[model samples]
Target: MRKLLLRSFYRIYQSVFKMAMPFLPWRRPVLLEGAGSIKKLPGLLEELKIKNVLIVTDSTLMKLGLLDNLIKELGINGCKYAIYDQTVPDPTIENVEEALKLYHKHNCKAIIAFGGGSPMDCAKIVGARVSRPKMPIEKMKGVLKVIFKIPTLIAVPTTAGTGSEVTLAAVISNSVTHEKYPINDFCLIPHYAVHDPELTLKLPSHITSMTGMDAMTHAVEAYIGRSNTKETKKAALEAIALIHQNLLKAYTTPGDIQARAAMLKASYLAGVAFTRAYVGYVHAIAHTIGGFYGIPHGLANAIIMPHVLEYYGSAANGKLAELADHLGIGKGSQSTDQKANAFIQYLKEMNQKMNIQSNIEQIEEKDMPEMISRALAEANPLYPVPRVLFEEELKELYYKIKG
Candidate 1:
């Protein structure tokens, strides 16, 4: 009865949300592939007549000089810029508030979110906060909570994950309370995304492996979620194909431009798919884990994804079989359950290839109850999970990962 009620609520919420999605303004222009594209950004900004811009990034990226090249471009183009490079791994509300102060102090007219998901998420919140100064950031957590956008926001991702460059959602953390908040609104999407593969070549192999799996999780969850549309399936299929063929190559040979480019495209497609189709318990639990334990977003997703899908069992079997077929791992002679099993095995192998560990010593037995509660709170209405997860099942899931 509880599962039925949860499913009913999820379906209704998704139906209403999807009906509204088509009408939402999606105006972001994506620069598909400008090889060696960092140089082109300054020219693009100048052409748009953007003068003062705020670059929100992390200190590591700034030190690596991944962000410095873009700043050099801005300098050469004569665009005045201010940088808030204090963005942490999971950006906090206090972090964003500080960034907002920096933004206002510079009298900035535009935003350039120039790192991985952290900076991008921070930029979105900062942009929304700047436009709707009186609105509480917490109020923007639900669907369509944001009504206005500020300045010309452009996303230039230093890493090939998160798809924050193209998505309409941002996840920010509450520093004091340690809860993660996801803000969803079409208006929160960036004005443009500079998908330059050059910027990601220097990324470490572990990061490449983890972020690639993060993209895969997005595509898989989007494909199997209750709210999937034809469009989302198409995008998800493309993303999965790209990841299956290129993710390993990219992980092994970090400097392979072609592989990195394919990975970027996969991430972008997965982002588009998940934003429309929504994600499931994998993301819900992963977000909660990151909030509570500070696990890297991609690593958490990679860890939780297989277990969640297995828990869903027959509910997600057909979709999983389809994915197995895409990877050419399933023969049509077998039952879909068998194909699904095959698919899960492939996922385990894929993780092994990327050196992803299956167990975490950090998750304690005591944290299981609260984690389950928070996971449900985040997923019950907003995410279209295939199976209605129960508290007992989540506890079991945690035990599996904890071991």
Candidate 2:
């Protein structure tokens, strides 16, 4: 008992010491939330002296009549913009090249990425490429390729997830090789993100469930990440609470504007949390599944979340206990270990309620070795993950989660 108590106190001291160190960096929009923020678009355009803008999105949103609504808003504000709504599930280099072509064709002075991460990522790349036509996308892979000032870029997320609007990192794929590249730069981050929950009310139930779970994963991972700090912990906790309260309401009733708005707020907070603190094995594994199977990014995150949390619980116990208390898990007598497992149990129960599957359809054990390799390849260096795994260990975890 003494040893355990001493270890917990030591861990607490280490966390406090890390918090005192001024290493973790924070970044985001000056202001966030609500419906009428979209009204600020014209002023932003005017500020940038942008007369022409290119909007990048996907066809599903276009067919849903959301595109026409946004067009109406832009017209009311007298913002000149053109639409190139061809962004696909896993946005590719080909998509970036094509969007760049359209940007130059229209003499677009700025870019507005509407929809989820795919469109936002494409727009970031488009913004970068328009400024540097000679620089190959491959050459622009690492940090800070967009050195000089380029076109003004704004992100308007229609979904209550992805949080691509505020993140400095954007992901694009090499289709032929089936590999995803993450581009990190201060310049790629959007100048504005109009997170109107009203926009998300139109999302289907499955989408709402998957995306909400994704936001929840973001908050959880950020709270326990190696790069965590005080501000990030606060953001992650509040975001988790919001998701716990609002996700079910939004999932069952897609037209619930209040629930939709709360979800949007949660996603934005999660973005802020993860932007500085980063993610862990959940994201690392999800990225691999997304690149390989073309699974919706959010669904992949949702499916892998509980499994990864179980693996990391030994390291993340105190944080997980705090998270459980926030979720109202204890009845005043439960130990921290019980609370920690309760949080994992809560997630498992929630996944079942949401109909999230444990098994990836048609992905076999024979493929485990390669999947583990890809997951590790993507996860280790970029992410400030809490726990590190070797190849065999990662492979074992993959099969364990595969069950």
Each candidate structure's TM-score, on Cα atoms with residue i matched to residue i, is 0.96, 0.89
Q: Model 1 off-target regions past 4 Å?
A: 1-3
CA displacement after TM-score superposition, residue 388 of candidate 2 (Å): 1.2
Q: List lDDT for all candidates, in order.
A: 0.87, 0.78
Give the C-alpha miss distance for residue 389 in model 1, angstroms.
Answer: 1.7
For candidate 1, list the clashing residue pairs, or say none.
none
Q: Candidate 2 residues 1-403, lDDT tens each?
A: 7545644554464465456446434346655457756666667677667778999999998998776766776677677787888899779999999888888888888898888888999999998887788988877775667665558788888877777777777888788866666776777778777877777878888888888888988899989877787888998998999999999999888888888888888888898888767777788777777777787878888888877777775777777888998989854688887888899888877777888887566456776666778777656555565565557667766776667
Model 2, residue 98: distance off in Å is 0.6
The digit string of per-residue lDDT tens for model 1 on 1-403 reads 8778876877798778778767768755557375678778888888889888999999988888887778788898899999999999989988789989988898998899998899999999999999889998988886788877677889988777788888888999988877886888888889888888888898989889888999999999999987788888999999999999999999999888999999999999999999888898899889888888899999999888888888899999999999999989999898999999999888888898889987666887777777888888888777877877778888888887777
What are the per-model C-alpha RMSD values against the true structure?
Answer: 1.5, 4.9
The alpha-carbon root-mean-square deviation between model 1 and the true structure, to one decimal in Å, is: 1.5
- Candidate 2, residue 278: the lDDT equals 74
Lowest summed lDDT across 10 adjacent residues in model 2 is found at: 17-26
Name the regions of candidate 2 deviating beyond 4 angstroms.
Answer: 1-26, 30-33, 76-78
